[model samples]
Target: MLTHKGDKSGIRSDFISDYDDLADQWWDPRGPLAPLGWIARARAGFIPVAGHEQARLLDIACGGGLFGPHAAGKGYRVFGVDLSEMSLREALRHGFDEVVRADIARLPFDDESFDVVTAGQCLEHVPDPFGVVAEACRVLRPGGTLVVDTIADTKVARLVSITLAENVPLPGRPPRGTHDHRLFVNRERLTGVAREHGVELELLGLRPRLREMARYAAGRLEEVRMVRTKSTSVLYLGVGIKK
Candidate 1:
């Protein structure tokens, strides 16, 4: 995790600015601002197994508290954290149980502070992913769960991923390259990193279909419209248990 202090918090500062600008839209569940339905879908894949209501959960890089209420409403004790103060403020405005402004790479929590630690789409933007993962591990109790969802890396899917991402009408979402160039990883690489951190893999799957590429080319996009093209551009969703 990169620690940002003083006048320069580095890349995190820049990313926070982007998130802050989109805070209001990000929290809204309706319209283009809502999370691509795939997020709720992906979270569902693990939430059942993770035991939402009884769990002590942390939503790392939870901009505008998008996923927190869903989990909180389910009965989990949710704490949302982000580098953007504006995002946190908006989260608090909506009555989030607790919201903190902290970089995910360097979480300020004590060891084993949470039962489930999640970083959805937030990993790729960090300067030190290994450190961020380590921090997630640090805060999770032994046998706790770690959930991650990020863009997948597949050679066959790259071209289609870029083309569709550019054409898609996602809200609050900018063009592919406008944000920092992303870091894409396959499941083996992801599981390897989790293994290095002593977390056991529980589940891994693509939420949106890989063949959605053909739908875009065939102009039958709505047939797969419910599928999240953004996360499905190849999404890597997994739950790892810390041993």
Candidate 2:
């Protein structure tokens, strides 16, 4: 797990390799796996924003092709892109329409190639989030949707170093091999970047209904503790649109 961030280290490439290595075990939803549940939940959050079956879609950092193929199943023409061939192969195995090897900084597609573009759990690992968003904007049609989900920079996220990501094992993930980042996006940062990139930002709040109760309780009441724990600890999702 190469956690070292470097201009020369092919960090993206290495990250892809790491996921590719775990591709087979990546999608299984039943395990005590942290990433699987998160991915599924993120995909569910994305579907409503993704629009209908007729839309042509591109999923960046598609990993094992979670949302893309599911969208394809719903009647969209879906293309998935990732930095790892190994992960793309798993996506192909699951019947994604197209899987390409590319970087989000510079997508290998013509302008306005997709009606909707989605990225799940990838932004945090990306070195240049603005660059990635710019490419997503460039490749989407004027009214296309860009949906993204990433690890939020909450106090809980700080504890990520000690807490096994609900998906990572008890042994903890190799440093830099998993979430390799110092900062995760907050709503303000996401909005700022989207504005800079010529996109309309929408902060799609993702906390479950119970989470509100929890925030009300933390250190104050026991019932509230449940809600606070889930709310603060849960991954946040946001959506931005290309106008």
Candidate 3:
């Protein structure tokens, strides 16, 4: 992860500013964050419907509420937390029941408070993503589910997620400095951290459906679908239940 210093790629180390700067682009299909909207739909598929009334879900680093609409009709009161003020404003304007301006590394809720917790596309930006995982788990109740998605720390991840993804002139290409490969999460350590916090995680590889990507690139499709894959060398999702 980030070592509190600049990386070898010469990209700026302050990643949070990007969210604030790109707040308006969060809902644009051809914007940098469009892929996040696609991933949000995939993540929603893993969440079972609420079994009881007032089931609570905490969405960490919820930028512009990309996960909100997909999470609706699931019978949960969604709460979002992010450090970006402008992003939180957009999140509140979306479907989040409540929005809190807070850092993911230091969650403010009590232990076992939320029935579910989700951290998406945020861990890779921190100095200690595992610590953020622990915080996510801390607020998650026993029998609660925890879902997270992030880029894996590997040469292939750096090549695809950062190099080609950012530099290529694609429809959903993120800003050039949006990713720092040195801060990518280690898959093994991620699972271990969740297990240590009483959650046994199941990791799944995820990527855009190639045909859908092509259609989206051609402007024939407004959105592309993310599908499961056998490889987790790059972007991946994790789902687990608290033991």
Candidate 4:
């Protein structure tokens, strides 16, 4: 994994500002934020919650607490962290058990503080994804699980997820420039980072329901569906087991 010095000054100020501007839309299923909610719900399916009823979970860059309530419902003690105060406030208003404003790369918790750590659709927004992954692992206890999902670095992903989804100006689509194509991460790199942090990684591809994508764009989150796939050319999910 890549190492960085000092605090999380490497994080982009503009990214936080952008999320802050959209904080109010987080819970609106029919809003441009529905896609994130969809992704969060889909990713939640992969978490091993059956025997972890009392596990502590920390979601880094947990904008609007998308995964917070769901994880809590599964009996996990959930905590969320984000750089945007507005986002954190929205998360609190949405009933997150705990929400903290902090940098993803410089988490406020102590080492081995959590039984599970998750960062969903967040790596692409940071300047140093590897550093963030290391930080996630740092706070996880031995045998804990670390989950992550991010867009893939591929031409198709750029053209579809970024160019079309962001810049097309379609109704319900997120505002343009919401994503930076250059920051997309591939499965190999993500798993490599986890491996370096003493975590065994498993990579999976996310195949969002096509019909659900349309529903999400139309702000109908209840109608969206997501499925797992073997192809990681568009989006990928990962689960790392800390040793």
Candidate 5:
């Protein structure tokens, strides 16, 4: 859930700073960013076994490394990158082989430096998610996988991801100012950008499992599973392979 430092939104610097404050709770299933862990599990399905030995995977905006565990046992030398030093430290302890403090839009790695790249749940916080997508593709070798998930720009998305998600009084609910609707992602533009970068992205919707959500609200479950759907109008994911 890291935000851009050069964000034109003028509202995400505070959001980025919030990561420091919440760093200790990143792995807590009952913590504010618990949804990230749930989505990471779903994202794992798209990540194939390492194609060869010593494969490398880069996790952009790898706040707290929720995906690290899922990435394990698959053989990738997982590298995490993010703007929050505190979050990077947390990620380092959570199975990531290494971590880098950097912005997602401008990766410091050389082209074709990675076998896989993932940007999860952070694009909606950036002013230029498409540029970040290009950077992701640039670092991925041909035939490498690219996976990303984000909140959509639709009005329904604003209502659900921001208006309800941040405002609802449920356990582990994010702070009221956690998201900026103006920075929500456009699915069409996201797919187009990936295509231009040689990755043919296939978009899919993600939604909380209702019965599990009710259990989570009632304290019966520590987390809720995000199921895939045909629609990409709200919370959605994009997965593809670089050509």
Candidate 6:
């Protein structure tokens, strides 16, 4: 049986509720969560999974199990954790190896238990991102990989990703307030937090392909690409290696 520890004290109940409400749509490639699938693919590309086929991966906030299947296909023994039972059910339906409903800030795992830990598009929704990172580090073994991706904390990011992409009411767009500008974490802040946990951080920016963006707006999932860019002013992916 999967162990679930910790209360939801440090978590944002509203955020969990929001995700639970959308749990059914999470796996819909042509739905509001299309961007998340693309983001998960891009984030997975950055992790150096070669020569570690037996490695164990823990995906925090693994809503609908987007990244879990991808990681599992790459031969990692994958486990996912989230706070929403509805979301966990969705993830399980997608055939993830293991899905547990638990708080990210208080992960139920032994120290140095995982070879890879990921928190994609999750930090922004949590009330305590630093606490989540600390727990991720605690669960990661020495030299393990830690992957995270989030909207950058910047004016352009607010204008493009949140205000426009989420609230503009375009086709396939997410609901309003899907993101809170104030909770967005920038590269510097995330790196600092990772460093505090004895992990060296590297930042990578994800730039949307205009054509792909248009296809996404039209609810088409084909050839959706979010490639690396020189600027992380909008969306960014980070990699950390535990020491």
What is candidate 6's lDDT per residue for 135-212, written digit by digit as tens? 998999998899988878799988987668876776557765576666778677778888989888888789778887
Report the lDDT of model 6 for residue 91: 79
Best by lDDT: 3
lDDT values for all models: 0.62, 0.61, 0.90, 0.78, 0.88, 0.79
Order of candidate numbers by lDDT, starting with the best: 3, 5, 6, 4, 1, 2
TM-score of each: 0.72, 0.72, 0.94, 0.87, 0.94, 0.88
Q: What is the Å distance of residue 71 in model 3 from its true position? A: 0.9
Model 2: per-residue Cα lDDT over 98-152, one tens digit each: 8899887789999988887887767777667767877887888877777776666
TM-score order of candidates, top first: 3, 5, 6, 4, 1, 2
For candidate 5, the 10 contiguous residues with the lowest summed lDDT are: 1-10
Q: Which 10 consecutive residues of model 4 have the lowest summed lDDT?
A: 1-10
Off by over 4 Å in 2: 1-17, 30-34, 48-54, 160-177, 205-234
Model 4: per-residue lDDT, tens digit, 1-243?
112222355432233334877888888776677778778888787677735546788889989887766675666777899988888988776657788888888999999989889899899878788889989999999888898999898999989887788766645567655666767886687888889888988888876588866765565656466788888888888887899
How does residue 118 of candidate 4 score in lDDT?
88
lDDT of 3 by residue, 1-243 (tens): 222344554545644344777888899999999999999999999887887897999999999999999889999999999988888999988899999998888998999989889999999987789999999999999999999999999999999998899888989998777877878999999999999999999999999999999999999999999999889889999999998
Better model by lDDT, 2 or 6? 6
lDDT for position 225 in model 1: 23
Cα RMSD of all models vs. native, in order, equals 5.9, 6.8, 2.9, 5.0, 2.5, 4.7
Model 6 score (lDDT): 0.79
Q: Tell me how far the alpha carbon of residue 220 in candidate 5 is from the true structure, in angstroms, after superposition.
A: 1.1
Better candidate number, 1 or 5, judged by TM-score: 5
Clashes, model 3: 1
